[model samples]
Target chain A: MLSIPIEYYLILSAFMFIVGVTGVLIRRNAIVVFMCIELMLNAANLSLVAFSSYHGNPVGQIFVFFVMTVAAAEATVGLAIIIAIFRNKLTVNVDEINIFKW
Target chain B: MNIELILFIILATIAAVTSILVITRSNAVISAVFLVLNFFALAGLYLLLNAQFISVVQIIVYAGAIMVLFLFVIMLLRTDGEPRIFSDKRYIKYFALLISIFVFIQVSYLLLIGSPSKSVTGNQSASINSGTIETIGKELYTNYIIPFEVAGFLLLAATIGAIILAKKKFE
Candidate 1:
């Protein structure tokens, strides 16, 4: 079986990370921004798994499990915060919900 | 040119394209759907990497549970109305786009040109066996047990915090 170079996975992860960053920067919708953040997290997870396989170690894969767990927790808390903000502000757009803005 | 490489190329293409779609679509729900696709494709990539356990968890936790939470929040907020796509200043967007492209080019150049410090000595069969569910379980329960339990506590705290935040009032 032919094997793929690890650089391919790293490059793909970088592309995904950049896409996520662009989404976070440009999208006004807070939830979409949250999705973009999730995208970034997933991109990092992909790289971690890729490197784990490359190094012949299970540590990286185990770390990915923790990352996923944290991500789940983050989603729960994040969505709750979003909902609270939506309830108080009546909108989910980041630009409009700037009570903290000076 | 072989089957594994071909599969990798196909899955990577699907992942990259869907991730782009995830961020570009105007509808949040549509974006979530695309993110689900991206997760599936990433799971396939993990399988290719011989991280079978992580691949399964990627599907279950990411594509299944976390996305459902996102969708639930989306429905709860009723964010169906088209939100403003960008801030009033269009320059910020252009700047962001430019920065993203620059970062992409820089990273790709480094990835393609840099010699990775450690040479990969992992045999395919060894990696496949090492990444098996049984191996992961044994390692997780033995060497990494403390972190595993701490993660359990973190999840519990998150659950309580979410409930508190979503409550109608802090009576």
Candidate 2:
């Protein structure tokens, strides 16, 4: 079986992160952007897990667990805020919900 | 190409295609499902790297729980079908693509230029050979206990916050 090197995982992470950056930049919907942010986080998590496995220590994997937990929390709080904003503004575009500019 | 490289390419293609579908499709439901495909592809890649625990977690947490939440929100908010044209930042779109290409080039350069380094101690794929779940459990409880507990607390706070945020205002 062909096994990919650790570097390949890093490269994949880089690609996914870039895709996520573009998703955030191009998309108008705040929800899609938020999901893209999650994608970026997951890309980094993939790299961390790969590194930990390559090094045979559980530290990177442990850190990834922490990252996942944080991501979940972020998703919850973020979605809640989005919902609140949507209820108020009647739209979820990043360009429109600028009430906190003061 | 060799089997490993071939498999990597296949998986990479799948992930890339699904991710593009996720981002480009106007329908929120289709996009969410494509994101699930992307996650599953990533989990497969993780398995290739021998991070079995991480792979399973990726499938369970991301593909299972998180996406379910996204679907729930999308349906609850009635945000299906084509997304509306909210922004006209055409210049920023081009800029983002250019930057992504630059980053991809830089990473490819590094990968091509980098030398193969040997593994560190206790990680030579020989020193400690065990299943991913067992090894991760031993390490998480023994060495990384504090962070684990902190993460748990963080999740609890987030759960409460989400409930507070999403609850209907039925006065």
Candidate 3:
């Protein structure tokens, strides 16, 4: 039963985090940006679980549980905000929705 | 080659590819579908890490509930054929690509050069068992009870706020 080294998990997490960052940087759709944010959150969750397993501590997993909770709340509130904005602006494009721009 | 390692490689590939598709797809619905696939793959990875409870929760919460919410919003908004902004900004895309490549190289270099210190706790079997639902339940109910209650309150507030934000105005 040879287990994977923790470094592999950490590296994978890093890869996912970068992908999420790229998505956030390039995608102009608000929903897509939100999804990328979710991806980043999931990346962090993976690292926490990996370290939890490595350290033989249940604490990290508990933290992951909290992260998931926060993610769910975020999605709910975020989508609602998007809907509200779309109602007033009739668009979800980040560039076009800039009413605050001078 | 061990079966666990093989499973990990296959699952990791699936996760990576689907996540790439998630961000690259022009169609929002298609991206959402790919995101669901990515979540499933990640759940598989969680299983590999011996976090059975978290894996199940990942499927239920992410792939199940959250995705359903996303699809509902997509359909409600009817954003199909919405003009994508990716083509309008070539410089941003190139810059993002360059940054991600730099990050990947930096992380790979560090991971390859630095050896992880061996675990000093030494009870790997016991630690592995801590990821089970039973063990997680005990910890959640005991030491982490206050945080759990706070999370519950957070959800309650979010639910109320969402309703307020999205509710129809009858005036």
Candidate 4:
């Protein structure tokens, strides 16, 4: 009975999270940055589900459910902000949106 | 390797590769598509993990709804052929990459070196039932009612906020 170790799922989660971090750092497009954020959230959800099933508890899964809801709300509001900025600035590059950089 | 292991390996590969593609693709639309693929792979992995409901939510809420919102925003932004800004501040990229790789090494090192006991292995039937809709519904209604109502309020606030934020001018 060689079940897949919890560490494997965690390793996968770590890899995705790192890739997401790299994206957030390197990419300038606001939308791309938003996608990277989703990637990070998904990575966290993966580990939560892994641990939930690993420990035979439903609490982690419930947490994942809350995370998903929050993610949805965050995406809508964040994108709307991006849209507002684009309407005014005519750009979504992170480097160029420097109104608050003072 | 058993069927679950084989499935896990395949889905994990898909998830890993698509996530990389999602981040690296030059065009935002292309990145969105790759992200959808990545979500599907993750949904499969969730199924393998015995979280049937979460897996479906991963597809419907994530792949179906959230990614659609992402794609819509990308199209609305019309940011095609935005020149790459990676030419300047090249060292910051390297710095972030270094930090990420370093953290990953630390985590993996801990996981490999630590001999966490195997006694935490869960009962199969219980784990399966734990992920079911019925079990989750009961738990959510009984023990997690406050959080559930709060999430609903949160969604309502988000909807109004999005509408207000997207409005062209304040009335």
Candidate 5:
């Protein structure tokens, strides 16, 4: 149904992945960084869906299913870790929480 | 010219803009809100690509469950008092922006110029029904049964791990 080139979707997702990387590198807030990671995942999922549709492969959709599962799990554990860290450090700023920074 | 193209353009734009906003916003709440918008836009894009099941799952899992979890965590942590935004070490922002722009240009050049006429001709009938719930469910039940079970176990493990990690006093 889509006549638009796959490159367009790939490029858009590429832009998104870059933005996520930029956010991860520069953002001080750890929560914001996690959100950036989600953005990157979303971008990857987009490209995967695009390729899947173009090739008419249900395998790609299956992989996307697995990805969604992993993402959900990752978010839960990651956020819980963040909460625990915040409890101990009283801050979510990456710059400040440097107990392991030697 | 076509309605589908127009919809794709609009959704892509929304996805792009909302993602940028999610990253740039200093306030975590605002970022969470924007991320929801981004997810909705992505769901639209998936719908365009004939990923009917994925689009629904994206909305239910990512937008519905995951984002609500994010919002809950953000509210729980409450990091608003700390001077929101580029107060110290501002150079990191510039450096990151420079690197991201460089990477984006490289990728765009590769995708737009390096690749020539990349297209996939697939079984039209297969593709038409590939996105339907029936096909995905069948695949999940048959060929992907092992992986599906593994995912369930992984989720169970994650739930236990999260509970353990977030406990008030773990000895």
Candidate 6:
């Protein structure tokens, strides 16, 4: 067995996903949290590629490409929304962004 | 332990730690920069997994394009310094902490309780070592035509949506 099992990569991805989740939850800054979400997405991508490699399949690798493209689009839209929020409230705190909060 | 295994562990730890820093740090710019570092480490992990195309694209799209745009917007907005972001929401910090712990537990359980046996040989590909960008390009345009087109359409919509949202206030 390779010292690093495929499971190891899976575990690493899981840890990263947890960390990203924590970052999203703990950070009040919208940008920080936004980056955290990106972190989570990348974690998922890492596992997908790792699993694909372990399986010796090209499908998962291709899926990673799709995920990357979507991530790019999501980041663009998300950052633009952040910009709009900044314009309206002059702040990027999720708490202060109570314009629509019920 | 093999070199790849050791390197993965070290890099994974670094990525996780820096990601924590990226979120906990008060400075928005610093957080953004750390996110870039996190992406680079992820790309490195992708490299170790033998997903050369994914790794290159990870760097190009994430570390290069997306992160630069994020930094640009953050800097352009001038919201780097603290100016009363979540000062009033005192409970939010605790709430976030709880959520993170919950997620960690959930994922740990799923991993532990799920299948421990590794599958033998369902993933062997004839073109693994030899297939390059040329093959990927051909496959993307051929067998993966529908999903590829759908992804392109999604990008177009996201682009239009972003432009509309960003330009709405001015008009």
Lowest summed lDDT window (length 10), candidate 4 chain B: B80-89
lDDT of 6 by residue, A1-102 (tens): 223566667777888888888777666678777788888888898878776776666777788789888988999899889988888888887878997768
lDDT of 3: 0.86
Taken over the whole model, the C-alpha lDDT of each candidate is: 0.88, 0.76, 0.86, 0.89, 0.89, 0.77
Reference interface contacts recovered per candidate? 0.74, 0.49, 0.56, 0.68, 0.77, 0.62
lDDT of 3 at A67: 96
> Candidate 6, residues B54-155: lDDT per residue as tens digits?
778888999999989888887887665653435636777678778877877787778667744355232335325422456567778999999999999999
Task: At residue B133, give the lDDT of candidate 1.
Answer: 90
TM-score of chain A, model number 4? 0.97
Candidate maximizing DockQ: 5
- For candidate 1, the docking band is medium
Clashing pairs in 1: none
Residue-level lDDT of model 4, residues B54-95, one tens digit each, is 999999999999999999998877795545545455788789
Ranking by TM-score: 4, 5, 1, 3, 2, 6
Backbone clashes under 3 angstroms, per model: 0, 1, 0, 0, 0, 2
Alpha-carbon RMSD to native, per candidate: 1.8, 3.0, 2.0, 1.6, 1.6, 3.0
Q: For residues A1-102, what per-residue lDDT tens digits would candidate 3 score against the true structure?
A: 226677777888888889999989888788988899999999999989887876777788999999999999999999999999999888888888888898
Give the range of the ten consecutive residues with the poorest summed lDDT in model 3 chain A. Answer: A1-10
For every candidate, the chain B TM-score is: 0.92, 0.82, 0.90, 0.93, 0.91, 0.81
Q: Candidate 4 lDDT, tens digit per residue, A36-66? A: 9999999999999988887778999999999
Candidate 3 - CAPRI tier?
medium
For model 5, residues B1-171, the per-residue Cα lDDT tens digits are 899789988998999999888877778899999999999999999998888999999999999999999999999886964354566457777888899999999999988885523655434566668888899999999999999999999999999999999999789
* DockQ of structure 2: 0.54
lDDT of 1 at A29: 87
- Return the lDDT, model 4, position B62: 98
